[model samples]
Target: MKIVIAEKPSVGRELAKVFGATTRKDGYIEGKGYSFTWAFGHLLQLAPPQDYGFIGWRKQHLPMLPQKFKLAVRKIKTKDGFVEDPAVRKQLDTIKKLFDEATEIIVATDAGREGELIFRYIYYYLKCKKPFKRLWISSQTDEAIKDGFRNLKPGTDYDTLFNSAHCRSESDWLVGMNATQALSISAGNRTVLSLGRVQTPTLAMICARFLEIKNFVPQTYYQISILLSKDEQVFKAISTANYKEKEEAEKLFVLVEDVASGFPAGGNITAVEAKPRKEPPPLLHDLSSLQQEANKKKGYTADQTLSILQNLYESKLVSYPRTGSRYIGDDIFAGVPDLIAKFTGHPDFGKQAQFLQTVALNKRSVNAKKVTDHHAILPTGEQAYGLSADKQAVYDMVVGRMIEAFHQECLKELTKITIQSGVTFVANGTVIRSAGWRAVFNDPEDDKKDEDNAALPKIAVGEQLPITEKSLLEKQTKPKPMYNEASLLKALETCGKEIEDEELRYAMKDSGLGTPATRASIIETLITREYITREKRNLVPTNKGLAVYEVVKDKKIAQAELTGQWEKRLEEIRSGSSVKDFKSEITEYTKTITHELLIAGASISGKLEEEKKAEKVEQ
Candidate 1:
């Protein structure tokens, strides 16, 4: 008999149904040469510091670096202390029994790094030696599942992926456990000050920005806008003025509009340039991008979107929810037509579905070279039914994104007209010739430009156009905004550079501060530790968070780029381009950071104590 183990019971049941494993048991399903079992997310995890014989919070254990981390059954919080999770242990026992009886094992966990770690930790903890094959399917469609079984790869082929995943888990544990304990102890705070590979830098970003904003003194700047009119056509032109005083801006506005009739003209409508631009449809939804769009449109937090997407994935309405790539693989391209056809009768797709049938779908998003462990998140083509309102919203996003990915590019004409007053003025406008793929998701708000750009209208070069109104606009130089969940995720993806280079961003994408699968959880960790709180959508640092940030602000420990570099090295290790020098480097870095933290000048707890004493004296 062959035993298959999945990450969760929901996934296990789905696979079991397709495989005809109908006989249900306590912890597994059995029928016809197959036994399907499931784990409750994680059956085993790395043992904590105390489990390694390191007693209570002490200075000697400041930088507790384990030579070889130990794995044990998952633990749960009891009234007295953490105890072994009974449900996990029982399921493990059942899995072990099945492993003992079966000739071979199949790992059917989620198709990503964390998923890989989850199963490997269990197999190692249980000391199971049976040879195993990997079931690597993205969506759990019956056809996809059947195809996966026929082409099962040897388990050893994924050793590099497992290595990367293991390294991630261990590194996060080392940094988070050591840094958190060291900071908490040094500060003498009774409350636990938590930090992690992703959360620490993220918290630092919010606090740093908050400080900058708080300390900033707003300065007024002025610019002049000219209203031009000719032949009943009206257009507005802006004066490029950098005036420290309002009087100077008024003088320039007067000179341009009144003193010299429309100012001395250097040129007027020298050329009218209009070119057709095609904006290809957006690729399918990846988890981060989906979270961002949802946050922007529906005001759902990143964590909320992740939860909703997870539910959608479990319900078999979408593909895997934690993918980084927005591209599908070549193998999955053949399934696209049928999938698109499933939406034909839906109100959202009734008109657009016919367009898909007539035009050849773009295959730019389907590249095997770009696909990692999992393809993009897409609808499973199953009829979505009986979904909660939140789930329905997310489902629509996925379906709409999928339909858009295959549709034709959006065509638009960009017109740039330059006008002359005393100073040169510019205006820009875009005429949409065809909405094309944008028709799939009818979002009118998407047409709005970024805040930096001013709206303009269509006018030919040298064509006399009337300005509707002229005014001197006063604006203040704005400080950076606080990191909302969406913006923070974008910052992480770019390693905090705010880069505009596509290739650089792409190179840095995989090395992002946190894996796509774990970023939402990292934000939650910050909130749980009281390091940060949400004021509406913006993440604001708490006192503890700010204190920690102040201490680490100048250190590599608080820089997202440093972590990105480390991630690059780990990737090199996976590809055999670099030796695994990570352990030694991590050991040395942990020691340095912990020592510095212990002796750092800031005394947050002492300050608190002094404040309390002063308050008592006043009373």
Candidate 2:
């Protein structure tokens, strides 16, 4: 019998149903000469240090770099401690039995780096030598699955992809295991001061921003404010320049441009510059962009958004959720019109969808070259039903974004009115000449100018207008706002852009602190380790986090450039570069960081104690 394996049970059942497989057995479904099985996400993980004879957290086991990594059944936390999950071990045995009995194996796991690793780990752990073909499909819809099976590629074609994933897993283990043990041992073993390659740098960013905001000194500044009228339409304007001293602003504030100052029609329209701009529709929603938008619009955390989108994906309502690309290839773009038509009945987006049918679809998001492991997330044109409120909200976003991406460009007229009052003042306004994509949601503009006038009355240069009011507006310089989920995700995507080393920056331009699939977990990990906390919408570092950041802020492990270097090497490995060289370098760095943390972590013990005591007091 041919055997197929999927990443989850739901997906496995869906695939089996598509193949007319309905005979359910202990751990699989069988029919039509195929047996469909699955792993619950990851069935195995790298064995812990103690499993390798590094018994306890001690200096002697500071850098416990295993000569060869071993995979153990995934574990769970029981009241006693973490142990091999009995169910997972049973599933592994079931899979081993199926692999032994199978004539040919079909790998139906998710199509991405992590998915590749999951299947490879299972296959190698089972010691199965059966040749397999890969079923790579972005969406789990029946048609996509059927097409994917018809064109299964040789498993060897993804050997290098597996190599890249293996390197990543082993490197993470080497770094995370060694660093975590080293720091935990040195800090009096009071509490687990967990650390990882991505988690540390993320924590450092939070701490650094917190300190910056805490130390910022605000300076009070003043600007001249005036109200001008043209044809019975009143608009507000502000001085073009700010003054440090109120006395200087007061001098300009009383220049007698108001009616009270006996200066009617004192405002002269020096220049009225109105320029038209064409704003193309935003690209389709990649995971990162969708998460950011959800955070801003619905106040959903990254993890929450990922979970909801995953549900939508499993239901076959949308495409893959973890994709990094925001562009669809032309092959997929060919069905764009039909997909848009599927949503012509959507309550919120129907009008826009109806209008889109008559126009040439925008080609901004259609680029086969930019499509990576999978295309950007898109609706499968499958009708959705009985969706929960959260799921429905996310589903609507996917549909709405699809409409916006293929709609016409928004034509806007930007007007800047330079008026000569007592001091030079300016009024800015934006008029949407054509709503275009904006009509999909009809949401307010996100990039509204500061002190912008909603609508400016028509006026010509060299025309005089009455000054309605004047005053000296006091303002204080503000520090950068704390990082919220939306801004934080955007920052994580471009973290390497500010690197002083041009080569490293260039290397990391395509990657950031973590992949789209892993970034949500990174934030959740920091919170799990007590390194950060959520204050309403803001992610703030705790005292414990600040303490750890102080110790490792200067270390290479807490630098984005380290991840950059690793990413550059990993991509090379994916392209058939030697993995041995990369592994050797990682081993050396692991030893170095383990030794440094053994010494540097001692400094944070007192601070951790202080925090513990503070927590006790609060309790």
Candidate 3:
């Protein structure tokens, strides 16, 4: 019998039902030629220092590099001490028994990086040598499962992927474990001040932004605005340049008012530029994009958004939640209309689904070369009725974007009007030519914009009109807004380079700070370590967090670019690059960073260290 191991019992049960594995047992289900079992995420992990005979924290054991990293069953911290979880152990035993008896194994874990780690760790930990095949599927739909079985790949085909995942785990263990120990020890050892390959740079982003905000000095400025009227329509335009003083602005404001009052034909409309603009529908969402959108629109935190999306995916209501690709391949695109059809009569999205049927599919989001791991998140065409309010919100976003992607462009007429009245006061307006795909969702006008989107009256070059009103407006230069979840995710997605265009940002995502699956956890780790706090929608660094940042700000770990480079290396490793070379680089860097962090921790928290020594001396 073939042993089919799934990532979770729920998924296992579904697969079991599909394969006729109806006989339920202690930790798995059994049927004809297949024994389906499940693992509760990761069953094993890299053993901690004490497990390797490094009994306690001491300076001499600073960089505890292991020659052969050992895998032990995952331990949970209890009141007595760290103990193996009984549930996890029982499941592992059942899996071991099934594997021992099986002629072959079928790996039915989540089809992603972390999922690979989960199964590989179990296989290696249990020391199973059976020939195995990987059953990779994007969704829990029965049809998808059937297709995956018919196309199972050699488990060896994913050996490169497993090596990549293993390297990531070991690299994190080496860097995070050593650096965290070194820094925590030097900083008076008061608390477990934590750091990680991804979390530290993330902390640095928050602290840097916070410091920028804390030190910003606002400057006052003034602008001259004149309200002009032509053909019974009035609109406002501001001075081309902001004046340093109100007196200068006032002087300009007077001249503009006089010039406008004298002119009959709209104050010499030197230039009236009108051009049609089309906004192609937004591409499907990757996890980060989804989280950013949810944060911006629904005020959900990054962690909250991931949790919701994950729940939706596990419920088989959506595709893989941890996808990084925002584009689907031609194969997936061929069936999109059919998937959208599932939402027909969906109560909320029924009309949208029906409308999308008539519109030609926008091939903008279809690119086979761009898709990796899994395609962008999409509804599984499963019933989405009865989702809680939050889940429904995310589900709606996925369904809406899919429908929108198949529609026409959102065309608008952009008009720029420049009036020369000793100074060029410019006015701009956008008139929607056709809502198109935007109509699939809510009104696009709901988004706030700095420019006045009021209708611009028809005017031509050389035409002049009298000014209706003129005034000097007082304004202050505003500092960069605090890093809200959305903006911060955007920053992280682009490695601190602020890019507004979706395609460019998506291109930069692979080289960003962390993987889509791990970024949410990184943010939460910062909060858990008390390194950052959520101030409303903003991620603010706590005092302890700031101090940690101060110590390591000059270090390599605090730089986002460093993390980006590491991300690139991980990708290289995933694509058949040598894991040994990557591990070697991480080991050397670990030594340097461990030393740097030790010195930094001592220098920054020297007073605390002295106090700690004094207390010890007294004792």
Candidate 4:
């Protein structure tokens, strides 16, 4: 008998149905020589500090770094303190029995780092030595699933991936557990201060931005805008001059207006240039990018979008929703046509897919080399019916993105009209020759416009035109905007770098501060710890978050780049680079940071104690 374990019961039931496993038991399904069981996300986790002989919160246990972590069944907090979840334990027992009876095991969990760790930890806890194979499929379509089962890979092929996942879990445990405890102890018993690998840096970013904005003083600047009218065509041109005083800008505006009203009869026609530009459609939706777009358009929070996407994934309306890469593998390309056909009946795709016949599908987002454990998030071509409003909104985003990914690049003519009035004044306009992929989303509001350019009128150079109006516009230099969920996610992915090159961004994707699978949870952790709060669309840090930031603002612990470098080293460790050397390095760095944190905590504690003493003396 073959036993298959999935990450959740919904997915397990879907797979079971496809495999003809009709006999349903209490915790599993069995038929057609297959037994399918599932776990509710995580059935087991590492034991907490109290489980390792540590009692209540004490200053003595400032940095509770366990030597060897122990795995325990999942725990739940009840009126009677924390206890193992009965349902999870029972399901684990059932899985163990199935493992004991089956000759081989098939791991059918989600195809990503956390998913790998979920199954591996359970298998290690069960002490199962039976041969196991991996079922790696990005989509839940029957054909995709059948193909995956037919080509099952050896379990050992993913040892490096599993190692990386394990390292991530352990490192987060070490840093998050110790730092949180040490800080909380120093902060007093009234509050619980939490920290983690991703949450700390994310919190720091928010607090720093808030401080910058709070302390900023706006400065006023003045510019001259000239309105030129020729043949009933009124065009606006901004002066290429900035002045601190309004009087100076006024003088220039008057001078330019005079020059434009009475130009020399035969001023030479300077330059005429028209360039053709092609804007390729955006790559397929990864979870973070999709969430970012949804937040911008629908005002949904990051966590909200994540939950909606998870629902869509469970319904099999879309592929895996947690993938980081925006590229699909070559093996999946052959299935694109069939998937595209499913959209033929979709309201948004019926007309758009018809035009797809003449469009040259782009190959930029189809590199198999860039894909890791999972491909990009896309619709599974399944009919999306009877979905909730939120799910429908998210599903539309996925389907639209998939259709856009395969469509032709948007073609446009960029016209730069240069007119002179004592100085060079320019007006620019973009003429959309073809809508191309943009036709998928027909909403005019959805079009992202470039605000720097002005719409240009068709006029030859050196043509005499009357000056319609002139004005000096006063503008204030704006401070950086507060960190919203989408921008914050982008910043985390880039590790604070503002790289404009696409290839470099792709190269830096792996070393991003946190993996796509965990970035959403990291943001949630900050909110749960009361370090940050959502004010409308912005994520502002709390007073406690600001205090923590003030302490670690200059330290490497608060910098995303430092964390990214460590991630790079961990990757190196997975690829035959000595694990012993890596462990030594991590140990040394951990000890160093631990000592620094202790000194910092002592300083904070001393200040609080001194304040208390002064209050008593005053009384």
Candidate 5:
């Protein structure tokens, strides 16, 4: 008999069904030759400082770098102290019993970094030596499940992935634990000052944005607008030059109105340039893209988006929700037609699906090398009618993207017409020659991105139109908008670089501050630590958050480059690069950072002393 373990009960039951384990038993199901059990996510975690007898946090015991890291059962904080969760302990006992009785074990957790860590930790905790095989699948579809079983990989195949995950966890512990204690002691306050490798840089982005907006002084500028009409079609155009003073623009505005009063054959059109443009359908939605879209369209937070996507995945209506790749491998591409066929006449997407079936698939989204552990988030070919409104919305978004991915590019004509009035004023517009994928949404009103997307009436070179109205328009140079979850996600995706080289940037995107699966929680951690707060859709730094930023602003921890380099090295570790190089670097940096923070505390104290003397002298 073999034992199977999964990340959660919801997943365990799916694996159980595939293995013919029909007998429902205590804390697990068993039948035939298999026993399927689950962990409640993480049953084991790193031992805390107190676990090693370093109970109280003394300044002398600041940097606690253990020679051998220890593991303990996951515990929860109670009124008195931390204790093991009974449910977790009980489940572990059941799994241990199965391992003792089984001929071999099967590890069937989610195929990702954290999932790898979860299973490995449980094996070590239970002290099991049973040979195990790994079941790796991205979707819960019956076909995907059966296929994964037929192709079980060796448990050792992913050892490097485990190494990478383990390194990430331990490094966070070493730096975060030591720096947090050092800073707290230096501040000389009971308030626990939290610091993280990723979260600190993320917080710095928000605080810096807030400072920029807070200190901005708006500058007024002036321009001229001319309302021109040709063949009963009217459109607005702006001046080619800007006037620093309103009076200067007013004079030009008056002259333009005088010309319009006479309706002089529309200030002779000097040039008309028209070019065809194409907007290819957007790529498939990875987790970050879905979260950004949800934040922009439905005002959902990153955590809310992940939760909804996770629910959809568990319900078997969608694939995995935590994927980072937006492209699918050829293996998965062969099955896309079947998934799309399920929606043929899907009351909501039926018409679009029917049309997509006839279009040639653009292989830009079918590169196997671009796919990582999982493909892009996609539908499971399962019925999706019973979901709640929020779930339905997310499901529709995923399904709609699939429909768009296979359709033809939208065709449009971009026209730039220059009118000669001593100074050239230009009018720009785009006319959709063919809707293509845009037909999927069937909402022309919503398709318009700006005035640029509006249709332009037909006109040729040297063509003249009547100027019906003209005036001066006053506008202020606006500051950059506040940081919202959508924009922040984009910034994080690019590793906070204002990069235009797509290939270079895409290569470095993996070096972002946090993993897609963990970025939401990192943000929530900052909020829980009172470093930042949400004001409607915008993220605003609190006073305490700003002070923390100030102390670490000049330090390495608050810099994205430092965090990004660590992230890059972690990826190298995933590909079998040595862990010793990274480990050595982080340990040395930790000591230097601890010392700097202590000195920062002293510097702050000196500044306070000077302020006190200034106050006394004034008095």
Candidate 6:
């Protein structure tokens, strides 16, 4: 019999249903000469240090770099301790049984690096040699599944991908395991100070921002404000230049431009500049972009957004959720009209969708070259019903973005009115001539300043207007705001953009600290480790997090560019580059970082103690 393995039971059942299979067995479905089985995400993981005979956290085994990694059944923490999950072991045995009896095997896991690792780990752990083919599809719809099966590629075609995944797993293990051990041991081994290739760099970003905000000194500045009127319509204007001294601003403020100053029509319109701008619609929603949007619009955390999107994907309302690209290929773009038509009845975006059917689609988001492992998340044109409020919110974001991406550009007229009195004053306003894609959500523009008028009265450059009021305005320069989920995710995506080294920056142009699939987990890990906490919508570093950051802030492990270098090498490995060179480099670097942390971690011992005492007092 031919056997098929999926990453999850729901998927396996779905695949079976599509192929007319209904015979359900203990852990699999059997029919039509095929046995469909599945694993619960990952049934196995890289074994821990103690499993390699590094019995306890000891200095003698400071850098416990195992010669070879071992795979053990995934474990669960109970009251007793961490132990192999019984359910996982049973499923492994079932898979083994199926593999042993199969003629040909089909791999139906998620199509990505981590997905490849999940299946390869299982196959190697089972020691099965049954040749297999890979089923790669972005959408989980029945038609996509059927098409994927009809064009299954040879498993050997993905050997390079598997190689890249394996190297990443081993590299992370070498760095995360050794560095975690070294630091924890050096710091009295009283508490676990976890670190990783990506986790440390991420924590460093939070702590650094926190310190920057903490040390920021506000500079008090002053400016003169005046209110001008044209055709009985009033608008506020500010001096074009800011004054460093209050006395200078006060002098300008008393220069008599107001009606109370006995000067009627004192303000003369120096210049009125009007320019039209066309804003193209935003690109489609990639996972990162979607998460950021959800955070900004609905106050959802990155992890929460990912969870909601995953549910939507599993329901087949959307395509893959973890994709990094925000562009779709021509093949997928061919169906954009029909997909847009399906949403013509959507309550919130119905009018926008109906409007799109009459115009040529904006192909700004269509580029096959930019499409990566999976196209940007898109609706499968599958009708969705009975979704909860949260699901509905996320689903609407997907559907709304589709309409926006394919709609026309928004047309706006920008007006700047310059006034002459004592010193020059200016007022700005924006008028939307055409809503275009902006009509989809009709949300207010985020970049509009509070000082800007919604609309300005029409006036000529040579016209004079009455100055109704004037005052000396006091303002202090504000520090950068704390990293909220939306801003933080964007920062993470473009972290390498600031690197001084051209090669390093270019290497990381496409890759950031973590992949789209792993970034949510990385944020969750920091919170779980007590390195950061959610303060309202912002992620603030905790005392414990600050303490850890202080120790490793200057280390290579804490640098985001270091991850970029590794990502470049990993990409090279995916393109048939030598893995041995990268592995050797990682081994050496692990030894170096492990030694550095062993010494540097001692400084944080007292800080950790203070945190413990503070926790006790709070409790």
Q: lDDT tens digits, residues 107-167, model 5?
A: 8887899999999998988888877899888888788888988899999998888999988
> Residue 473 of model 6: what lDDT?
82
Local distance difference test, each candidate? 0.78, 0.89, 0.85, 0.77, 0.82, 0.89
Residue ranges of candidate 4 with Cα displaced over 4 Å: 54-64, 258-272, 443-455, 500-503, 570-578, 602-619
* Angstrom error at residue 363, model 5: 1.9
User: What ranges in model 2 sit over 4 Å off?
Assistant: 496-509
* Residues forming the 10-long window of minimal summed lDDT in candidate 4: 263-272
Tens-place lDDT per residue, model 1, 449-511, is 432133344455565443456677898888888788888888888777787543456567767
If candidate 3 were superposed on the true structure by all CA atoms, what would the RMSD be? Answer: 3.3
Quote the lDDT for 115 in model 4.
82
Model 6 TM-score on a 0 to 1 scale: 0.96
Candidate 4 per-residue lDDT over residues 264-319, each given as its tens digit: 33122244567898878878888888988898889887788988988887776888
lDDT of 3 by residue, 74-124 (tens): 888999998998889988999999999999899999898888999999998
In the range 114-230, model 6's lDDT, one tens digit per residue, is 878889999999998878999999988889999999999999989999999999999999999889989998999889999999899989988888899999999999988888887
Between the candidate structures 1 and 2, which one is better when assessed by TM-score?
A: 2
The TM-scores, one per candidate, come to 0.92, 0.96, 0.95, 0.92, 0.94, 0.96
Stretches of model 1 off by over 4 angstroms after superposition? 258-272, 445-468, 500-504, 576-579, 607-619
In model 4, the Cα lDDT at residue 32 comes to 96
Q: Is candidate 1 or candidate 3 better by TM-score?
A: 3
| 115 Cα displacement, candidate 2 (Å) | 1.0
Task: Give the candidates in order of TM-score, highest first.
Answer: 2, 6, 3, 5, 1, 4
Residue range with the least summed lDDT across 10 consecutive positions in model 3: 257-266
lDDT of 3 at 283: 88
